[model samples]
Target chain A: MDGITRLVYGIYPRSDELRVLISRTERGKAVTGDLRDRISRETEDLLSTFRGSSDIYSEPCVNWHDFFRPVAGFLTGFSLGKLQRYLQTNTFYREPVIESDLSLRDRFTEIDPPENLPAPLFGNDKEAWLTLPSPHSIFQASKNPSGIDEEKFSDSIFRAYAEIATELGRKGIVLRELFPYSDRAPDFLGALNGKFKTILVAHPESRSLPATGRNHKFHSIVASNQLLARAADSYEVPGIYALDGYNTKLEDAENISRKSEIAREILSVPRVVVTSNQHFDFLPRVIADRKLAVLKSLGAS
Target chain B: MTGGLVTQEIGSFRKPEYLSTVFRKGGDDVRKLIERATLETLGVFRDSGLVNVGVGGEMFRWEMYEHLADHLEGIQFYGFVRSFDNRYFRKGSVVSKIIRKSSAHLEELQFVASHATEKIKVPITGAYTMTDWSFNEHYPDRHELALDYADVVHEEILDLKSEWQKIGRDQVLEIQIDEPAATTNPSEMDILRDTVERSIEGIQGCEFTIHVCYSTDYGILYKALADTALQGYNLEFANRDTLLPGINREQRTGYVDVKEFADRLGDRILGLGVTDVHIDDVEGSDLIKDRIEFSTRFQDIGRIRINPDCGLRTRSRETGFRKLKNMVEAGKAFTDRT
Candidate 1:
């Protein structure tokens, strides 16, 4: 696959139309058919743009930041509501999308291909990816409001995620990748691991260096183990572990190396990738870089 | 000395409940409250027609720490897990789960286009600090986690920028990415600089500021700034010089000499913190003025943004307000002189 395809498949797509859907929801308006159609069309356009591309390794055709602004805007806006819901429902801000947490639609009827998403987006030489907050993120997000029943919340999330996954699969858009952006993400790996080909696990930047010193070390380890164990149980193919570099303390490279070794030992996953300090920019690069290296290593290049 | 009472805007104080809920439950109320209070505080500052308003505290949810922990696994070195169960795992990870169980509240603050015409400063904690403070879990290596944190934050900021754009805001928006850990270690400094640059990249229209303090070595901070994309640096001057044994005093003092250091940093604005958050007695305007004058010797000081050494969450409301008022008065006196 070319770079654009890789990026489209590897990275999560943030659609402006989706943001409009979210905005309308924020305003307490029912999603209009026109708005829904626009969103579906945009999603289809995005999918077609990648599906039409012949070069899988070519540099992406557009600046990623520019391309995803609307999506990011929508997600941010949606986050505001998600956060508000956490406060109203649970009385705290629990991170809803960490690894340890449940899926958003485990019990709900699987997400039917979002009516807005095109049918052919993943038909040929293309893959679709979705990025969700980790289970730990749910817990963290819940911290803002203090009155949630976590067990019940987790159950509902699992139900919702299952529904979404089932629906997406029905649409032929394979959920090939999942990114656990926060500490709490590891908890729900079991639900997502079997469903996706690759799961990207993130680590805290502050702990990678000697400068941080024994702070939050315990939490980091447990989250990783949860993800690894879940992935081990769910997938026949080993999961991929991705690391963040910006928050890592460069002052002590030896210590960082040692930590990395320990992590490798613990996670026991295949294909660990290291990202530059700025992860978003570096994530695409790392994935692209690794894809070629993996092909070459396998003698396919 | 100014005689007016210095009361902190309600937004400046992050109550324990607020912190806990944001950390544990994931509510929107904390952010809503913050936005509401920020507007109220700004109104008070404008209504008082005070020459300057000492922006006091920030709404740092500890849950963010867990979020960081989940994404960055190398933080195990920091020993932050003593307080909770499953120190090995960060608390929240899934969006569906978080939304389902979250207790966060939301209150939207409508920003008038006219209000934003004048510079409105927004502060965000740096990826390094955020990572350092959280219980990271996602990445295997600390350096790797740092990079991921930077990316995550960059994404969030980019998203934030788009939201600002939709509201017709422009470059006058001043954003400060706070990095308390930048001064302490070389590795962290490198990460801080790189992450700050990444965070500021593409968001060209705004005035980007960086706040560096509460560390043993400030020299690293200066060095880090040489590589960052920010236009301003806010340094803590009041308590930086106080001796803290076992910690390198030279590094700390070097960090305090930000004015001289920043001068070498071309076109960078300096926000010199004149008020001490730790000091119980309110610092007089004269003392603050002397400090600003002292800072002038280090660099061609442009427009100075005065503030406290750090957030006023630790102080009584009365003390916090008094200190902020004094700092604002001192800044006005300086601005008038210049």
Candidate 2:
């Protein structure tokens, strides 16, 4: 706790049992009760791992169809479009067919976050974060058959998020799967300086992190170990969270330990955060479970 | 002489309702059902006048990625992941050293060989796509994993080609390596070239063509694959171009990459996609003719083979049939005029 701030972001993988129940329920074969209990059991296992392993962790979103879908389901002004490949991965999310201005139909927290999460995590919660795709990401993935201006569309999405953060008193907002879809940095990112924000780059490439000017105090950058090893030296950030979320070779805990030590020295920070760089939703439940024990082992020495 | 701008299919066609339902439920005699469905689809292809039938429109398989991953030794599926709205595919993770457990499409080729009178072009999921689609658990890196996959693909193709020869045919097997994931990762262009070359290298008496459709930028692929042993490219243009009939760059904007392909590569075929498969609105033969005529500006008409953008699996059987029929009519129209 003193030298390293272990953190978890993105959806954790769901168990096979839960997956079966979900499919059955969707097909009208099983009831929602069985599905709910299975998700809780899987989520409890995830939470227990976080208790000793990490300082800050988002609720393991075992039920998210994808990162964007859960949030998109609650928001208005969009219809589901054809499946587009999400960045470089094999997995896909339904694209938004933007029909109207975007806004949340209901409170973002109550609709998307699972019911079992601790009540304490919601109001001004710094310990747990609610994750959403950055407005720019949403704007980029959207299909505007009708022409929509970039700033107007993105601001409409950000206003709803701003309301949620204000209503819930959340201190940390994590926006994930970031990319430089446009020529310049997204304007919403500049307005995100008041509280702690962790920007998870989907694939850390030369163009992954958009050029940004920041006066934000608690801004942090988390990315895959491969990109960090290759070209993360020039990325200036207040905090660097390094994790091997993309590859399944149980990450060498020693390498992460060494990276964290170097990060503390180089970034001139006392404690560096660590978490998986992307969603573990596509990984087998067993491998994702094994990763929890590995996360617990970081900075133990 | 070949039919000018020979008509063909890219790969998948929508499975018949009975076969698809039974495929999900998993009962015995599914193989018989699959064969019946395949032959029926073959009937449609024959009536549509396609010169090259692709395993009767890939009827033996559900998807390109799952079909190959199901046959590999090192892959383990987690659960169903959504590839689109409500439709999902099993995305496997490579947990150990990969090896081909069995040939994915040998039985498929054998079936088509026995039934098809026309020349057969077998569409198999290429090595690069297989590697890019799976999660790597064991490989030291993605490059190593892709190379290992390349070996498996080479072996699978050689085995299939041998079976085709045993049938006592004089024709060389035309293999279309489906690589929809080719242009997704720009950093891995070198890996893409290496994997394609390794997959097709030293396979005598066979044609190696790649089917890469709907790429954001086809220029990357044209330049990167110029030196590979690949014989031609099957790409999509109707998805992006305007359907209002015109033969210029403005109307047929999607065929702009034809100049790049012709300039960079020498003497390669172009599987020109002249119809949009995603939409049900059938392009009349005149519209498809316009797209084919549009490509003649950048690529030689002799080197062009006609096709749909990607797969018609997304469309209904009736729609897929009509689209193919119209495309064939379009090709013949171009042929008669020339």
Candidate 3:
């Protein structure tokens, strides 16, 4: 229990203003000067709020759907569901299927961070983390896996990610987290381990960590849906436990935190980031804020 | 073949404009809207020639979790929790205690039963789906969690049935348990089956049906679930039509092969989905006829109940009406031919 050190918060829900901006942008509505200014101002406020809360691991309001849409032409249900915000979930995301060569551009890799935010928001690139959908998850959800060379394709994705990580690291970014859809981390995990401090946000469904070099922190999405009987008794690196993703009520937040603490204790992993299971975007700002306060209290040793 | 081409909605109806507006308002107005919606839903089914229809499930606010969660005793509505590709309700406790448990759906069901002249089937969110879709703060284990959920659901169903009897309405033809999350975790197969059994344990009056949608990879667990003594297994077929194995290149069409499902289900009903709910494109009567005909080749047509892949909640009011109408027309066409 004593090994549990720092508690880092990441991916807070998008502020209403930011959500409005993103929705308008996605809808192809022309967002001009006033709206842009409003978005920037809102972004600063949201970031400052998160920064004040605790150790900020990731940006509060990054639209992850904007990434990896280049090869969506070959895939079905690869983009956002036009009818609803989430395809099947309440959270907004694009279920990307890497069908072919994952070609990248600077536009895809660049962190806009919404200009006119506070200097700390802009400057703490070193402390900030960039989350990428794992190459393994992309490959698993791919349409025609037989045609693509697994090694080459994974390496290609890793190389692009590596370039981004290198650039971001040069700018002072400390970590890059992979949102893995599958249990198997790509072969390039070892390679990326050599480049930067990697973190794998374990998919709630696939709780098992990929058999790779211990180069990443395992962020576990411990929804109370499953039995706690199989929680990892030990870990190679420090782990993070994210509780209360979709519909966790406030009353249960502390209980979840306590359960997560027990799991952390059982694992005996050092420096766990006790946070929400998924991005807090599904919640309203006020509710998300309340959740953060609750988590901050419960997360503290 | 006694009940001439059995037709049922998979327990959801798209809210019409009038009803949608009524939902925005509250108090007595909401009850009036629910009554109106229930009547309209029955009309939609009757108009479309569907024999067994639901009470619209409009009171559910287009979400299965919200419908039941709001009525439960001890639930903390955490905003959202992700499972696989979707997010559903997360909570501390699904059911802390069952005393004085009441829901608007129960009231809606009573109203529907009182007014409905036709055979009625009620959609109950299954124990597994409720627990699987929620975050548990109380239960010691998954099995215990699911069992607790089963107890709550079982109690709720009994309450509904008890009220139905008290109202002097005819028996509820079927109690459909929608379990979209049942097959997601393979390890929980036994628990899922047990949950279903426990939910419908002593209920004698109505036939029990478990509806699974989106994914069909039930493995050996399908057989296990069937053995739990369910009357029917309502499965999504048309939505998965594209994924079905085709005979040739140009002839890319075939009725979904549910022979294995039929064999596994034995004498139990196979509420076959003849219409696609996920796609906007309306499947013609000819297509439905073909699908039903193909199903007959493997299973007894007498046991086959024509239905859409899942609930019509995601579809528009017009689309749902059209789809149901098309399904019944196709079922009639098939029956005439047979």
Best by DockQ: 2
Interface Cα RMSD in Å, per prediction: 16.1, 2.9, 6.6
In model 3, which regions exceed 4 Å deviation?
Answer: A1-10, A15-42, A65-94, A109-127, A165-186, A193-197, A201-237, A240-291, A294-301, B1-3, B21-25, B57-62, B80-95, B98-100, B166-172, B243-257
Best by lDDT: 2
Question: What are the per-model DockQ values?
Answer: 0.01, 0.35, 0.19
When sorted by DockQ, best at the front, the candidate numbers are 2, 3, 1
TM-score of each: 0.43, 0.82, 0.77
- List the lowest-lDDT window of 10 residues for candidate 2 chain A: A114-123
Place model 2 in a CAPRI quality band: acceptable
Error of 1 at A285 (Å): 39
Across residues A125-216, which tens digit of lDDT does each residue of candidate 2 receive? 33557677877777778788768888787677667767766676665666774454332344345455454354444434424344334354
Top TM-score model: 2
Candidate 1 deviant stretches above 4 angstroms: A1-301, B1-118, B135-138, B241-256
- The residue-by-residue lDDT of candidate 1 on B44-155, one tens digit each, is 4554344333332334334334433343333333211111111122222211111111111111112323332333455555777664544334555446655666766666
TM-score: the better of candidates 1 and 2:
2
Residue range B1-338, candidate 2, lDDT tens digits: 12556888999999998898787554558888899999999999998888888889788898889898888899987656545433456777899899999999998999999998887888888888988888777888889999999999999999998898898766789999999899889889999999999999899889989998768888889889888888889998888888788888888887777788888763899898889988989999998988888788878888889999998998999999999999999888888888
TM-score of chain A of 1: 0.38
Per-residue lDDT of A1-301 in model 3, one digit per residue for the tens?
2333333344455454555564455445745454556555765665565555555355543333322332232222233222212323423334454444554454433333222111122222445565554566555445443376667666777677677656556321222233433444343444455565555555555544444534432333222223223334212334455545454445355565565566556655444545555556555445677767665555334
